[model samples]
Target: MKTTVRRDVLTLPVAPTGPENPLPPLRPPGDPHTPDERAKNGLPRDMARQVGYEPLRSLLPVRLLDGYGRKRTDTPLGTLVIENGRLRATVLPGYGGRVHSLLHKPTGRELLYRNPVLQPAGFALNGAWFSGGIEWNIGATGHTTLSCAPVHAARVTAPDGGEMLRLWEWERLRDLPFQVDLWLPEDSDFLHVGVRIRNPHEKPAPVYWWSNMAVPEERRVLAPADEAWRFAHPGGLRRVPVPVSDGADRTYPPRSEYSADYFFDVPDGARRWIAALDEDGHGLVQTSTDLPRGRKLFVWGTGSGGRRWQEWLTEPGTGGYAEIQSGLARTQLEHVRLDAGTEFSWLESYGPLSARADLVHGDWADACAETRARLADALPGEAVDAAYVAWLARADTEPGEVLAVGSGWGALEVLRAEYKLPGTPFDESTLGTEQAPWLELLRSGAFPEPCEVAPPGPTLVSRNWRDMLETAPARPLTEYHLGVAQWHEGDRAQAVRSWERGLERALSRWPLLRCLAVADAVEGHLERAADRYAEAFDDLCQERRDDGAAWTAATAALGREAISGLLAADRPEAARAVWDRLHETTRAEGRFRLVEAQIRYAEGDIAAVRAVFDEGFEAADLREGAEPLGDLWAAATGGEEIPARYDFRLRP
Candidate 1:
């Protein structure tokens, strides 16, 4: 049977991803894996010094996605399916173009975990990440900011002249355009994925890519190496023997007591691959071309906190799964430097492999050998390399049919730089209202201002856009955006000046006011920042229009920040006032419920704080390392044992 690609709908109970936070993420969203001095000293020479060598300063150009709640409803998510009668792969175009399912037709078994629900959790760098399937993480160490964002999708002819699903987007973080082409060869068991990342800029860019696959945790994961770089929560990295670590066989997810990352130290020149097989030695195997040399296993162990995290990421009753990932670097912490005008390309294959149950489940080395032998017999490494070569020839082929539309930022960049991206066209038609003002600035000399009442539009922080905004006529809107751009570029002094200038004639002062508040807090002016936050919230309330829904979301987002700032400044009454002003629905969200507990704690109402937790709540966007639940519990009960349900602490 010839490989076929078709559009389909994956209907599931999906939580609504509400409005994008209007605030620019002036701070790096908490990085759980940030290594400390001890961690830096603990690494092997290769990755030791390079830990956080080129980390993201902040999530700019991209706004935080903290809008999702625990509430879910039946939704039909758009999907694209490709099958060759032997293997079937389902891709969700709307959600990071994730490979949602991989089914082995002959055995009638699902290879990937195949998440039963589409629930957004606070895992992605910019928030809103769902568990399961294969997620293509690019641009940074943490989950890609694009996890919950859409990417441009289209149909293209594969190397074998079959229909291929191509998902491409201009990754905003690195200002690079990348593509992932998925196709299954006729009657072939393996599904081939060709990935390419192009740096069209004049300077070198740090590139990070990890194709993460979620497989059943019950399976024993096997990699080529015996030693792996282990990075765990509370921030430390150590090279430890694989399969066995901390007095236990670490390959089994349930054995570890805490969540961790095991980046396998695959020997140089080894055929790069990782597999997770059941007790019967039947499951998924992912093999990739040499360029993607890194392999990893991420486990949320059997501990209550780890299990709670699993439950938080998906439906409570769902079976747990672990991640088997492949990346371009030796480890996720280290980024490979891609030269200007050059590109990073590789091919990866995913399929099932069956081996002798005794050998697969026996000695560690034997199990690895058994899986490798089965993989070579099933689909040789030479075949994967040859497939990549054939794909490179067709990499530039223009897309035949457009499947889905992503953000217009790529098209905007293409227009700005006249990028000749062939297979993946960021056409001008993709441009929307978000790009309208910027388009005007690109064409006309002036930056058009928004309506006096409407909140400022999204930010554009690329150097090119920043330079443009710097030169444009300095109106309130122009200065407001200029401040954001300047802040993104790490020019704090200039950013403050720009925001302060914008506030001079700004009809809408909340955005600018909130920005200044952030600046003040960063500079250690806590009380001053709180005053600005209160004023900003008040301004937003005054500017709230008849459109209740939009305003409610905006108010909630700004209100949360305002309340937090107020509480930090020891202004409990002021924080309470902002809380009172929030919409009823907004105040009732799990995130705000936690905030309410904080407010009660600040007001010294220990009973009220305890009462808030008695009525259980889950902060959907609970940040990594910010344990409000634990802190609140301790404050309320005076060192009582933290309940298992609220305990998401990664460390003991």
Candidate 2:
């Protein structure tokens, strides 16, 4: 079966229009009459009455099995309950009081419930004197009070007899909406209220909301990438990036434990928008609202997880509440400046798609195209100019006759010299400077062999060396050898550059490139060193071989040393695998028993490693051949520290 990737996009609906009617009134307060009077009036006479004469019967019963028992009534404000298996609130009705939205099972719905109304202590409503209301002691102003009202579907009254609009709908699979619109008095300064949502459903629903609310984390106000705005918070302030293209969006995943708060300002005429996109890019819900001239944008997302007010707002590991606000600071809703009589509005939409494939064909492609165009526009123009200069420089210094001369050496030398170039007297010291030119000549495909080895006279040797170094100043091979010499003489930086230059010129010439890498490793560029060794090893491994015992032994030894070096560099796991390969290769060809013992010891099989050494020692008769094995055993058994005694080297 084949696999496929999908995408999804969410779009918002148009805003509502026209002046809407005030919502319906809340239920009347419970009767305070005696059981007989209440019965005659057709009220629930058996309702349990609490202090302040508030009837608690409408609330869902808090059974002992439900974990609260009778004492459940002694909860903090806004506690929801289940009575007759229906969810309800336990707070007195109205602004100063709490209201609970209960979640019902089966249909997975929530029912709204209100507490008793509390008017000022001495205030009279209708014909009765009401003694229930919130008391505020402002300085010396004795007492100011507020009352609560019952909760209803369309309309509800605030403590001060102000009206509010409530829109609520519940469905099993669909999420519930519990929003209240507060009707502020023409001159009111500020508004505040506490809300609670109760969920009794078996499955948790994803709940989210946006409001003119502020929390610790500064609200994140987002707009189209083209919009310009500034972000402000305790973190300081900065102008927001106006994306010239799409696919640029801001995200604030739920912060598990961080305090955050900030505000954003949308310029007077700018439109501000915010959105929440789920992980798969599907199920996007967005809100766009008009901003008052000079109003700041506020956005926030909840950073914690848990049951809050009986509602699970976020998933256990990942969930948060986000809010996008318009304008800065809290100011008079009407007095706030605006361009003309511009109406401030918010747009929101939420829906699920059939699959992510829907988004890829729609939103994702558009976003990608926009991003590509923007990048193309931003690219610097000088890149092409730089390339043109580089190509011109290469053409100007093209090689001449020396390349042909070097190429003729192999044929000339084979005719006279019995021994070939490999027989040349080249050791570590001469390898860099004295012999570098010849090596370079050999490395350049132009030369197949060294200058014919003249007789061992001083004049002949000097002439050969001078000719090799002088012939190819432009060839990459000469510079590479000189670099190697500089490196051996302790001029490391020069060595590296020379090797790099050599690599650049001869990369397509694998043999020379591989040799330069080897030189680099010998100069303590360990990473480069390992790379060179690997290249060499790969080349050797690919060639079929038999009967070349010395060559095979030398190659295996090199592999062993490289593996050890990797181990000492804190790559034990990688080194172990390399060592395994080395062991198999060496064992297949019947060589390096001591190296095999070392491999076992390095792999942490100390006992078996020691036995190998012991056997080798005994077989070699203890005196003449046992010394190395004895030392190996000592290192494996912790009698001697390996690195300190050996400096990670082995005698050839």
- Model 1 sits at a Cα RMSD from the real structure of 1.1
Instruction: Write the residue-wise lDDT of candidate 1 on 4-110 in tens digits.
Output: 98998888999987888877889765788787778787466657544556789888888888899988999998899999889989998888999999999988999
Output the lDDT of residue 246, model 1. 81
TM-scores of the models, in the given order?
0.98, 0.25
- Give the TM-score comparing model 1 with the true structure, all chains together: 0.98
lDDT of 2 by residue, 33-109 (tens): 11332222322222122111322221110000000001112222322121222222222222222222222332343
Maximum-lDDT candidate: 1
C-alpha root-mean-square deviation, each candidate: 1.1, 38.1
Predicted structure with the largest TM-score when compared to the true one: 1
